[model samples]
Target: MRRSSDLSPEIAEEAAWWRDAVFYQVYVRSFADSNGDGVGDLEGIRSRLGYLELLGVDALWLTPFYRSPMADHGYDVADPRDVDPLFGDLAAFDRLVADAHEHNIRVTVDLVPNHSSDLHEWFQEALHAGPGSMERARYVFREGRGFDGSQPPNNWTSVFGGPAWTRVPDGQWYLHLFAPEQPDLNWEHPEVRADLEQTLRFWLDRGVDGFRIDVAHGMAKPEGLPDMDIRPQAPGVLSDDVHDPRFDNDGVHEIHRMIRKVLDGYPGTMAVGEIWVKDDERFAAYVRPDELHLGFNFRLVQAGFDADAVRSAIEHSLAAVAPTGTPATWTLSNHDVVRHVTRYGGGAPGEQRARAMTLVELALPGVIYLYNGEELGLPNVELPDWALQDPTWERSGHTERGRDGCRVPIPWEGTSPPFGFSTAVNTWLPQPNEWDHLTAEAQLEDPGSMLSLYREALEHRKSNAGFAGEELEWYGAPAGCFAFRRKGGGLICALNTSGASVPLPPGKVLLSSGPMDGDQLPPDTAVWLV
Candidate 1:
């Protein structure tokens, strides 16, 4: 494969650029705000191109920026073909793509094929055209089951809260695994398939390198829309083990195959799915040669900061993709979950654990998607009750706090809330006051800071040529420690998950997540050796 710096169309079409690539996930709404609307936009991302380039990421996976009602923070796409006015026009998107390519960075946007906004033209037409109309066939619209059609068609629950079926004024119930405003599409319809294919080509033609498909596992519902027999888990959690009839249906693979056919025509362009299949063999199906190029395995994210748990998570993730010849995608935090720093344990301990896991994720084969503020050791904000914006907040009867904490605008500069995120005092989500010390600018000057660790680590990974291949050789370690060597790279990555320090492996120290305790690797720390 050619270097990203000299990547030409010929090279792009022929090479697997995604493998071993480091992608940064940019939640556009919270990234930056050039127009000072208190919400990030395309131009804000453009202005930060230099910063991203300096960070040494190979590509960027952007969350949805399409025309949306913001019901699900851009996931409720009203028009897949156009940029939402909230994030600038089509020209701004084109410019962002151009600028990204100029910086030798690939750009991948989110594609939400599982559903569309209720305000979408197709859905609007369906609402106006009445029952049994052709337009209604585009989405999942069925009659309620009760005598007077008062009950839902099925007992399925929404991922957010309550019933998955939303009743319309016409006495019809529509399927929405997520929020009601985001109605699930009838993937069985030929028009839906054709339209999504068109949408894929539209962005690909505009120079987007690939797509991170949203809720990719939910595209194909079961034949009868059967009632799931399992008890519900916590809100917003979908485990394949739960046997939720709403997800991982056999028909989904056909949809992926169709998507892959379009992507294959564009060659090197990738289609990464947000697949949550827990069964290894079933998960492997999504990444087969004819389907998605990559399927994110969230086991690592869900694992605790303990040796056995972390090791098992890694082993499981690798095993799932090993059969398909696809590299496992690694990530710790994203727009949908609580930040890893907080999840690890929070405070100084959480930061240390999060920093250590970063090394583990990067050392692994395949792609690493770093959420926008993770490199800064940003913790999830404790937003005021009124500041919550996730639909789950209201949908869950105000019981669950939802994901608004993690979606807070990133701290770029300044010493207060909004930081450098916006010129306006009111940001869409409030930034925590404690984040002043964690701002990129504040951390840039400190060699010991989280941002510095990421920059240095990325630079080393790129220049050393030790991360070129996908082979890991595991080494037995002390009870609370684990180590793995990159095959033929003459490099080793070791971690100490125990409270007590452990002996450093035999090699020259390349990098460490924290200061070593003499010859010992400290607890909650990771180190790279050469």
Candidate 2:
């Protein structure tokens, strides 16, 4: 860790705790079960703090544990202040925060500000109040009957599928960018913004170090409600309005400015926005210093293993944010997306390829998020058709298997029932039978395991202060290789993405992806030369 006094004047100004932080994202449903209720809870996560500390992550990003109706997982929060009963209430959350701090790990919970569950008391009241009521103004409500009472206000499509607008039985239409159950909030309302600010204060006062804002770009919508041109990709599948300017309008900047103002009152509290945009330039706008502290890099997740693709993404990201004073954050996988192991490694050579891919992500120029099972080199579990619980499966006509496979419980103990996650009658998601061989306990004992490699890579990253906040200069390399220098404090990292010995660029080898023996790197490895 770089001490405050050790930081150079330029780096010191940008030296926030998250600059070099390694964040571990935990999907609460699959992490661990404390009461054996077949579901992971706050206490379950608390129990695993030592293991997380051992892995050397700077912080833990817990997916929604707040009160919800389980629509879109927990993103449709019904009550922001209270913890869900299934996740063990407010007291258990307090304990989890305290325990993590004891282990020198920071805690950041998911904050879904864009919408609220239909079952929420406020939404329920809005439903009864009809249009023109003060409570109804809290959400977006169109004053009119639907087209033939069947179509929505506009032709916009929901992210999950179908129309973005839904009509209440009372003859009013409302907008929902994602799922119908999650009604979008009206950010234009002063009360709504004030209420959200209070919610932030409530958690900050409770000792949360920061938050990972969910679907942040969807907070604002175009006021004109223009019709989106239809371009049906699949039969009955529309892709036109999907990128409609009205959907993710420029008004989001105002919303971000308001959020940053709230964050200003609480120092050292970080907010990372989940901006899902294809254009790097537009995505970088969300990360300006006055806006969000970090904007998620979905490019890395979608890059796969193509050397040229990876290079373009890194270079584009750096250029996109150069005008803004915000730093970049990279991730290979997350709860909503397909697992990196399965996405990048789909065939017989998947394992070796995944090993090389990890090195590529770690050597990037920003904070990196490591998914739970990635360090263990776990592949996506193939769940039976009947076992899948993800709403995406049903929503997408089963075209995609949905995220249930990746969301399965994390195996902690080898040869244990439910993989030691729960002792209840059954877990929400069943653990794979192969978990016996893939458990953390099994891999921790093996030095050649992916888990051990992750430890070494992380330690190497921390030891090199130059790599933390220094600017990256990309160097041209072979077709399957990438080299970058973090040229300060005398540190340079050159990574080889291929499975063969490549010529070294001259410095002592600091870390390697594969086996290391007396300064020699194994094939298909990455080496940090210092």
Candidate 3:
């Protein structure tokens, strides 16, 4: 659309909001704790509306706050229709949505449809009901493999670790692709489909703008739940390299079509799927007109701090989504992975690379998701072993230290522990003392700080006409460096990934991720120009 003609940013945002919106991911429990209970709640998020508005995000993708057992930190849904007591009641959630909209920030919520908490009434009923009962049919329950019915139904393993099956007291086994406490829902079941539709209606009626579907690649298993010859992902990676029978099943498309039908009833609402398929044709299928409005392509997040790797990621991600006529989505970190700062190389150098990367990301053409505290240049906190809580940790027999580091409560404004996140001294995960210098309070006033750079970059991305483009054209650059111009707006974005500085592109400098070296872009730094 941008290449064809100029559309005011305001008009474009209204016409198709998800096309170019910047969404901030609020990982609920660690964002802000309102009642001083040491865990972030709905009220805490409502209180932070002003901060988010000031940060200039178009929407807030709040992670699940539904009635959960917290077994998977809210991903384990017990009651999808109501807010958990820990996060306050439905009234609190409604208030948060209303307040967020008042600040011009649309609210999207996480919807976990792949599985239900084992404590869910249906699952609990399935436990006691006979093997052939209708309740059992709502889940993927199957008979055991061996003669004694002692072995699991299949050799498949959980993404968290161990076997993907768990045995019941009745001697039958059920599939659980993650933790045993989370039982996979039988998407083929009419009751399950109806319930999910009702769920979409329930949340939409409550004013939720859209949904960020969890495990969007999962749900529909192939007929005769088969075995998967899987390769174990490396440590700290819940990686997706494709060719796993566990996910990205062809049957899953019909599920997305059903969800799309429900979402279509609400004109302004959208659904963005967290798909992990690597085949471009298969990945593109998830975003077809009758499917998800947006499907997250994580190629960029998996790339290292190298220019060639980053270039390849962008090109492939763009190509993957091109067939569907959907805009590409870009992100560097999320609640599940190690933060980009630490991944690039920890300490001052890491922060510099992160700042440079942020500029590069913001300059891109499609939807962008920012993990909370990323704007403040937060790095993964190496918490003591005693404090780790990710399910991956216990499931892997403590051999793997899961994602607790990136999920640490972000520092808001104080110089000590909790950092004004909560009035309580102890938090869900202890905050490191080193964060005294990285708190938002400490960075807001510093022009050179990461927060300030983010603010400046966001303002330009939102208001500057030069950023109006649906795609970018590559520009020739020196080795270990790459540059691109937004196809329509002529906005130039350049990154110097090499060890030596390079001359800036010929344009009016708009912003720099680091201090400029005369007329040059410094090593490991990025810049935006018009």
Candidate 4:
């Protein structure tokens, strides 16, 4: 096994660093805390560079840490160019970028282009400037419906629940696909496009490696703010339903093309979009040559733990990017969604399946993103209702528990709450006491731990030539089992999703998600044979 720094000079010379890369998604607030303020910050991330390097990741895809009022954590950006005081100043970010590069790790920050915080200077000015003013033109402000302008401008509801259009004091209604504090921008407005382009250049000029565009499919709306034919079954979840007129509109391609033009000016810097369009044809459009370098297709994330479901997800995801020749991004968990550990089942079974899926995911030929705390076999924290902070909790009228479960602070080195996440006893989101056994500190010493499994797998993926290539050949296997061979690599990854044990193919066992019975793979387990 080889470290990321030991990659062959030739392999590292590829112009696109993100292709076939393993990126670690750092949800800034939950990653680490150097300030003892019970919140993670840029300094904390900088201090943990060595840990990430040891884990063998090629890059860091950090979620937003920009200046905001915490309306939706950092997703609602008040200032794109400035760092939030809670995270650190611009100097701190510079230091983080400098140190991260020293570890041979690339840094990609989140870009929330779909909307801006209502507290943003521009949005505030728009509010005071009144409707139809140039200042108001930056956002999607419109007139209301009904005789007396009493109803919302449109029938579209927010992903976070309630009406998508919020009525302002001056009688005009503004579109906010998310929370009311986050007003959707008018992409058709030249000023809005210019401002976002400037924001991209600002971060790129600051030495940030790239950006992960938030709501990439959502910048542009149809000619008319038309009402969708469907309603979201669940509030705040990115709907995969194609009838969602509010997202993945044809106009969004132009916005992406403009963003791509800005990115093209800065060579080697990539732009990845968080696209939720289920249609492969539409999803592929965002990653067209003149658009994003990669688009996040969530088929795998939404799949069940069954073998057929996983296979279908992977097949669809691969087909989505086959035409473009770009790397297909694979992710099992992120800041949103239930952690894979919990999603698979819960205790032993869940951890086993999570580990199995990790092998399956990493084995695929593409860029893999591992969410923070995932390598530690961390499950979602079931927080008390009083501890919930996700905007959806209130927006959904408390009917939906929201995403706070997966955003808990990571357990670094200790055996109790906060672990080594912070010196302060109280973290922004409370850590579960049962996480003592799963801390990085504890796992590092256990050979059978998920941390060790990930370290070994990543190192192997980096060092071994067998993990190369984009083609996967399916091998005939028993029912509920999936066995696929790497096109040129002689590497076979097999998963037994059945009730009974399955016989292994002829090869040396390189890695197994769990203890195996000689050459037999038990149910809910995966193995890499070479």
lDDT tens readout by residue for model 4, 424-529: 9999999988888989999987899999999999999999888977899998889898999888887899988889999998799999999898979999999999
Q: Summarize candidate 1's per-residue lDDT along 401-472 as a digit string, tens digits.
A: 899888888899989978898898999988878889999999999999999999999998888867666778
For 28-100, candidate 3 gives per-residue lDDT tens digits of 9999999989999999999989989988899999999999899989999999999998888999998998899
- Poorest stretch of ten by lDDT in candidate 4: 1-10
Question: For each candidate, what is the lDDT?
Answer: 0.89, 0.77, 0.90, 0.89
Query: How far off is residue 125 in model 3, in Å?
Result: 0.5
Model 1 vs truth, CA RMSD = 2.6
> How well does candidate 2 match the true structure in TM-score terms?
0.91
Model 4 pairs whose backbones collide = 159-236
TM-score against truth, every candidate: 0.97, 0.91, 0.97, 0.96
> Lowest-scoring 10 consecutive residues by lDDT in candidate 1?
233-242
In candidate 2, position 503 carries an lDDT of 70
Clashes of 4: 1
